[model samples]
Target: MKPLFMLLLTYLLCWQVSLGQQNSYTGNGQVTFSAGAPLDLIKGTSTAITGSINQVTGKVYFEIPVKSFQFANSLMEERFNNKYMKTDRHPKATFIGEVTSFSQNSKEVTAHGILSIHGVSKRRSIKGTLVKEGGKFILKSGFVVSTKDHHIESPKLTGGFMAEHINVNLHLQLIPENVTPQVATVYPAKKGLK
Candidate 1:
């Protein structure tokens, strides 16, 4: 009986450790968006992005607070939250899906998931690079968001200050759940990304 009990305890501990190693969470994630038109350009960035990933299951998830984004101009920020995004009504944008293809040797990954923004969800496939460094997995990706797809109407009243398409970039450093949390290295957006 004592031997059986010890075996069960060992099994449980191993299972728990494996599960923890398979899952990771972002310590500090950054999300940025850029929209440009012939007349003007709009850019915003947020450091409040949060998410988790399971390497074993290939499941990935991320969420960004709508109001967390900051703009260079205060008026533009207010208009973005209240008039455009209606952040009070829909406070978060999220993506939930799985990594369809990933190769540790190649460091290339493709994820298929549902991206939700402005209360609308759309199926999407996003390609990104993933690298393991210093006990962390770094993810970087860039994609475009269409205002029409998410029902974000860009009024002509601003004289084409907003573009119909917005380019988004993400940088995340994820640490395994079992590991001690440490300060993540934040990478700056690449030049000419817009």
Candidate 2:
């Protein structure tokens, strides 16, 4: 089921690019989570993030594979996916929302939408900065997610190993489909040297 979800996301990303729609951008993105308890520090990151944005509509979407997140320690990673996250049951996290008050002149923007994780969906708002450069849109944002809100279990045995609130950071560089030149289907028949 996880593989199927990933495949579908890939297909959608490709479709978004192939459509060649104006003001639409898509790219591979990154997400990171960090937290600290009294005794233990928890940190993980996943680069296997697929995302897209439609500037015209101020809409954005992101899909992240739970198994893709990596921790510094193998045992921690194992426990995260198997015990805490239960990746087998809920293998992916997704977000879909609209960027409110988005404007080409404004560097800061607010996004409001649904964030689904651990089989639970919750309304969330994120604040971030956007910069357009070299034909790419670079976005950065930070938000907090509560473990209890998503029904994530915190075992007593793992005391002080996890924090109640998780800090999530996002960095995305997106290329507009319309601005990218299409690959030439057929090379111009060898041009004769003048």
Q: List the residue pairs that clash in candidate 2.
A: none
Task: Report the Cα lDDT for candidate 2.
Answer: 0.82
User: Clashes in model 1: which pairs?
Assistant: none
Q: Which candidate is the best by lDDT?
A: 1
For candidate 1, what's the RMSD? 14.3
Which candidate has the top score in TM-score? Answer: 1
Per-residue C-alpha lDDT of model 1 across residues 1-194, encoded as one tens digit per residue: 54456666666776776667756555559999988763566789999998888877889999999999999899989989998899999999999999989886899999999999999999999999988887788999999999999999764435545478889999998887765333334344466652
TM-scores vs. true structure, each candidate: 0.80, 0.76
lDDT (CA) per prediction: 0.84, 0.82
**Candidate 2, residues 118-173: lDDT per residue as tens digits?**
99999988889888888788988899999999998764334445467888998988
lDDT of 1 at 159: 57
Runs in model 2 with CA error above 4 Å? 1-20, 103-106, 155-162, 178-194
Give the number of colliding residue pairs in candidate 2: 0
